[model samples]
Target: MTASLPVATQQDGTYPRPQLMRGAWHPLDGQWDFAFRDDPREAPAGVDFDDTIVVPFPPESPASGIGDTGYHLVAWYRRRVTAEDIADAGAAGTGARVMIRFGAVDWAADVWVNGTHLGSHTGGQTPFSIDATDVLDRDGDNELVVRAVDDPHDVAVLRGKQDWLEEPHAIWYHRTTGIWQPVWLEVVPETHVESLAWSSDVPNGSVTLELTLDARPADELDATVELRIAGELLARTNVRLLDRTTEITLHLARQRNGQQYEHLLWNPETPRLIDATITLGRGASEVDAVSSYLGLRSVQATDRRFLLNGRPLYLRSVLAQNYWPESHLAAPDAAALRREVQLILDLGFNAARVHQKAEDPRFLYWADRLGLMIWGETASAYEFSERAIAALTTEWMALVRRDRSHPSIVAWVPLNESWGVQHIASDARQQAFSRSISDLTRSLDGSRPVISNDGWEHAGSDIWTVHDYEADPEILAHRYGSTAAITELFDGFGPAGRRISVGQQDGGQPVMLTEFGGVSYIDQDVEGAWGYSSASDAQDFARRVGGIVGAVRAATPLAGFCYTQLTDTGQETNGLVRADRSPKIPIEDLRRIIAGD
Candidate 1:
């Protein structure tokens, strides 16, 4: 039997984009026609969708209302869009652009509007959009069809923790097929903001904003970018749009008195955000405007310690996979996402290592607003192939571009436990590939640290991270307590029985115990639930947990630690809370243990 669903209300049906908000939007997130095809060659247009599945929830999820745990190579979804959905457009239907946006669809997605193929997207973790303005029928209804193909065994596809077998096992869970995130319709002007990338230098008191605009070659455009803090205009500038992308750097370094502006830095304790706006204009006529927000923060590592906003900080984080017993990978709603973050913070964790999956943007938005540090990670494919490398590289670039602006994200984890490149230490090509991806991530955004391969056999990682499930507190402390012990443990053999250091050594880089202490606490009713080690009862679990956490906290050389998980996932009974987000141990006790009280 599955766990009970969380009693949280759905999001207020607002646009999913919190960083960049548009005035008008239509969320397509209720119910949709769903069909599963055995043959991968099946086309969505030819099939008559007979079954109904909830939007934004995978077919395997109980919340989808079609709980088919079996592998489905191809899945199709059909929905109708009426002109009323885009009626809020600028000119009712004349020269108005209606963009169809999908927060994410697993594996690969082929979209069609009004029987016309708009485009296709391959990445499952990043958002994509298509301008359906030309194909939209303003007077009547339009058919929207999506064909999603997901093959968990195919190493070319980044499947995260999705189990390749027919049933869930170990750390891998059920497959998330079809649209796993929100779908919506947005109306935009001809020359609206496509995307924005923000980079801040808190020490220098400056921020560089890059804007990518959706414009035609014929439309000449200029933009006025303004930075505001509580209604006061901090900086304003204008630039000619000679190209589709333009960047401007706002230096808030000096005041009229030749003194530096006292900048507010963002951290888990204080996540202050500054408002921003970009207005596109043609000569003197304003064509389009978009609103956004940013936070000023910087992350750096020196002397084997992490420095957030120029102050040394220890990361007390949890391994958050963002899975639900009812919805699988999808949250019940936006409020559920916020609740999860609040839960993490309430448990005395200032940060979370969002393991494997590239989480929904709404979670990151809340993390930014509510002050939670996130280690942005990419889903990994198990096998290393030309196709796998291409898929991972493409999706990781898009993921970085999509999430780099958020101040809550302090690091980018490209791979986990050498899942895709397992033989990196022995294989020359795999080692090169690992370094290439690391270099590429740094090139994309140099502001944050990059963990090339998180768990072990590190190739080119900014932070030395290891995963150990040793239940004995003495053994755990002996493994990573001192610099000499760390060097011996990492330099001799790795945690996963592989060679510890590959390309980089355990230099002065900060060392983090990314995974450990998956102590199991199974309810008597829940069969097949297990963790790394079993606990007899709540008292036993608390004693073991306190022992492990106290040992890690006393470790002088270790920079931080992330417990095995925040909540229980399918078959994994190692969560601090159960699958339904109910606490196993007392909240106060768990918080004290995690906080080293």
Candidate 2:
């Protein structure tokens, strides 16, 4: 019989310094007892604990220690945390409530601690946090069990690139099962800061700060928020909390009092973020303090161009899918995610259109820390049942709730070109789901803009996002004021000879070459044959991407663009870089075109 891995038994279980968390995160991502069953109802009793597997990484992943025997099944994770852990947390001033946070779990999960059921959640892409203070065994070891179920057959849920067909082909892969995200516990003071929200009104040179606090009736429960410009204080405000939520507005008076006028406003070239510190309390006797920040920028489209902070700013972006063979959805470490960000920065791109799904929180944390603009999207690209729809809607709301604190995410795309949404002509269920997703995202997250659909089939979004795959860049430039190429290679060729057509196309909107390059998998020398076309060489891919950059730049009407992809995904090899994150082509090739050479 295989021995089960020992769970960390310290005062605090284990805190892996996740490369992506803005602050500190206790990583509950280590080994835990796992079991897989054909029917979730036929769960094994606790006495049969030997049938367990690992937590976070799906049973199919190599990291999960279960070989590719292929168990497309449902299971539960069981572990025990002592009351001593909770007591230690309570002793610390930061401790008030212990919440179990899941980075992500596949399909659906229902959690219970110490025999008390917390709640159930669905949607595989977003994070979910639940308060486990009351449910814990305060005096002894507490049993924690997470039951998760994923039906690969269910198409209505948002399952990005995951395939139920076992073998991943073309652009899909084996579905991730069970908890795939960092699971840990955090202790918050009973009267701690619950959430933070920010809005950037660059035109008026002002920002509104919204703080949600725990219900605590202290004599002076006013929250003080201080704003800083490049480590220097610009403005500060103190507002009284009324029912756990309060909004305070701050105006940045004239470009940091005498610095260069251009230096004051945050521009694309020199993007700036105003840091903030929120303190809850009366004078020195503060109850809690949370560090947060916001950017002085806005994303909108005008007759002149896609405006950032009311100024015409071009979006030289890249389509970034947060996936790695070794790590799958989760990054190996925060540094790994940071390295991905550095790769984009090195590629001369300014923004990342987080393709199909929302990324790890740490990825967003790094984006905020690194000044990278992000388009935060929901995993809404699958077709599922009515039960799945209801479950997904709850998951989407929680996703926005957990992520609304980050400022790096400037826009939100809830649905993508209708991946799982299906045929728009006759599916009323799909249309309703699309509309419902848009409404939920908009209502939950009002701080940033939301896109109902990323590529095609616009439901209701701030921008009319259009996806095009024409041979002519100029013709695309005339149409969809801002067009994005969801398919990286147009007409199946590289960047060198791609055309720049003129006249009206795509409804005459600004053009954004969103997706162009794709999978240059690491084993390209061995597996680089393009079945669709004969001209599938590294040079061909390079030439195609290089040409599009030139064509778009040459055609001044093009607002901004994104390459086909940041890395080769599965079998769709056209990336400037390989799937293993090794550079397939030189960065100079892309630099030259982005520089308009």
Candidate 3:
């Protein structure tokens, strides 16, 4: 297994955005005064303080010190930011702005500083920032207040696996109400780089960088771009920033031959990253600078196989729920996030279908460093309505804008199990919605394939997939054994008694057993513990797992496969590892089977 690169710093000072690194930032992830109120007050000016809860952990989790599972339609949080903290963030100087960024706040959130209302954001999952430069009291304590509202029964909202009931049941788990991720402060110049996007052309050995600036430049500014590998400078160029957005392409020096490309191209075997440094300058003095990295690779779904760098690479993947017994959606710590990536590689999988939730960026960073492919997925809204469409489209697109720079994300799964468009099989409007989303995803980023709706009843997809829990190896092999059977299965019913192809499918696209082999195993029976197929003991567990995975590997028409899950989340016990992350059997035994040896 490839060792994961150590996180650069601890949680208190961890750089949340690893690809784009800045030196001036301060984390706001400690104790905060919290209270539950769905009252008439818009802000928390006169509200009484009741309890203290940890930042970045929702009130539902035990880690937050308040394990409230009931419906709290509205929640309030307040914290005092000292002048020292602002100065430490480097935002107190002239022409510098202090931006308070929230990793995420559920449903909707309204922010206020010193009793002045800044604004409100609607998306629950995506990150947001507010400039507190004007309202912040630089010499004294600045009271920052936030009001969060996450309606427990709002099915129109994209609530991934968060169960709405009082207790978790079936596939759903506990709710993560408010502030489940980090909050931090950063200082930036008036004209600074906002974000960057990279696109690599492997055949030409050139990478194009699209840079977005914070504001329009009053005068023409010059910028210098540098690319390095292993601390060795590979390419350096100068670009003129006449507009707020600019593009520059750099042709790498040593990627002229197949052998050189093999050594430097990003793959699970050789995950080479070219470090980048961008400096914005006004004549001679440096205005702003930041550090980032890029991975030169390409992915496509073509000719019945998933291609990585124009080569057929079979995807040995597991469905990563990315949940924990303690932290629900958030990682217990930075180290635990790294361990999750390492454990996936140790189990002999090259890719992961990060199911449901749009995962933390830190997890994506580890995957990029350790060379694991990811099928990026987003949470889904259960009901089909105008509100659901607007909510899902807005947040899902924002998620794409935020995460498109990560090289480890090879594909995008906008919806799963036909969650939002449940009636796509028969309804035309839902079917149209599914197709439009797939088209939109392709339009935004054409570098990778997009699965419109996973599982059966696909409206449109680049690679056709199916979810079958057929435990018998012989039956499973025969089901996907022949090309004729494989071709016919798409036009007919699938294992779930739903049509494999509904609206549209590319004739030459890849066909993979993306999801299967969910055989539940445990020491003994516990309430609500179940699987499609059960194993009685260790011997049976190994046999069932080995047989199911081997069956998929032996099937000639199958290009790839993803096992049921990576970990046992909530009530689901079909994971390869236990909920506490203990190996049900020896790790090596499972690795051998998963690797098809």
Candidate 4:
């Protein structure tokens, strides 16, 4: 036996960070005994294999130690854990509860812990969590089994850009399935804070906090939520809404912290957040408490400019696809995610459009911690309708519920370039469907901005988003200068030309070159064209692409720009790095142009 596989080491390699911790109970994500079975029903009884792979990282990814291979269809992962790992998690003296968390699993996954079958989940994108306090063995090792069936090639299920074709062609995309995220168990107190959500009505001079708590119904607990600035109380409220959902409002008077106030606000330049504490008490006896963070920033359109913290914040952003060559859609490790984010920040960009796929929860978690704004998006194929719409809407709503609290996410993009919409249909039906989905997203999350269709067609959206591919810079500078504030510039192929029919000004609006600079692919092993067309190569990939990026940077009229990609996917070599994560161009070179160095 290879001893019990070791737990995952944090960046510092000292303590274990639970997949997502609320209090004391930490999750077991580092090691799991696994077996690749031809069929799902044939999974063995216990941790009975020498072959061990790290949990969370997909088996196909190089980081998982399984190396790169397309062999898995249905694989099983098993491990044994102890209850003692989560005994004292909440604050210090609070009662404990254990919960299981999955960062993400592709297609579907079936979980069984301690011989009791838990349940299954579909959809390759969002994260899921479950309470496992009941099945935990206090003094003995408990069993954990996961049956992962990923059809990375499945055409029917929402596979995003993952192509079923063995040889990726056109814009079909790379395949990533199975447990692509970390899985662990968390311990919490009997009466404790489950999660903290914040909404800043900056113009209203107030911030509202929605607190979700998990505790026993019989216990009558006094809850006091306090918001402080620089170690002094700014707003304190005692509420009796324990044992159920509760809302607390804190109004600011001159931005003071009970004593002396500072006029400091959160912005892209200096993203400021306050540390808050939730205290649960029975009269004077403090039963439980938890620590949380929140940012006071707002993203919206004002006088034809996107404002951040009441200033016209120009977003020189890029479309970043979180995929490493050896790992595919998975990052080599959490540090890799941080490194990429830092690269963007170092480039002097304020935001990233997390294009196509829903990134790892930890990625978003760090985005919040590091203060990078995001245009969170979902993956859609070249199809559309009520069924697809329903699925997309359901998944997006769940995504918002899980990630809305994060300060990094500023916008939600449901459809991109009509990837999943049937564009062949009449414009009326297309517009109606597009508008419907956009409206649905708005109704669900009214706090952040929503982009209906990211490319040529503007069915309806809060931002006049576009994607342009024109080589000439003058077209955007002078051709279309009098339009809505949300104009998006694509390869000029979709609706811009048609929308400006019969001699009308194309009002440049807040001209954002949403898509451009797909400089083509030139990896020795893989040869392919850029997604939309064929106009680039490996020899000239960097210079040609860098020329375009530099051109956009020099063009001051453009509000923002999003290069076609951050990393290359299979067959698509336009990324700054090769599909396997090897940098195509030197980092210092890209940094020079990105940072205007």
Choose the strongest candidate by lDDT. Answer: 3
Collision count of model 2 = 39
Q: Which candidate would rank higher by lDDT, 1 or 3?
A: 3
Candidate 1: where is the Cα deviation over 4 Å? Answer: 1-14, 88-94, 216-220, 253-263
lDDT of 3 by residue, 352-458 (tens): 99888988888887888889999999889999999999999999899888888788999999988889888889999998998889899988799999988888788
Q: Which ten residues in a row have the lowest lDDT in candidate 3?
A: 1-10
**Whose TM-score is greatest here?**
3
Model 4 lowest lDDT segment of ten: 1-10
21-119 in candidate 1: lDDT tens per residue?
655678888888989986666666579789999999999998999999997888999988887877753344335578889999997898988888899
- The models' CA-based lDDT, in order, is 0.84, 0.62, 0.85, 0.65
lDDT of 4: 0.65
In terms of TM-score, how similar is model 2 to the real structure? 0.82
lDDT winner between candidates 2 and 3: 3
lDDT of 4 by residue, 78-166 (tens): 88777466553323233456667777788678888788877787777877766667787766788778887875544445667677766
Cα deviation of 316, candidate 2, in Å: 2.2
How does residue 443 of candidate 2 score in lDDT? 80
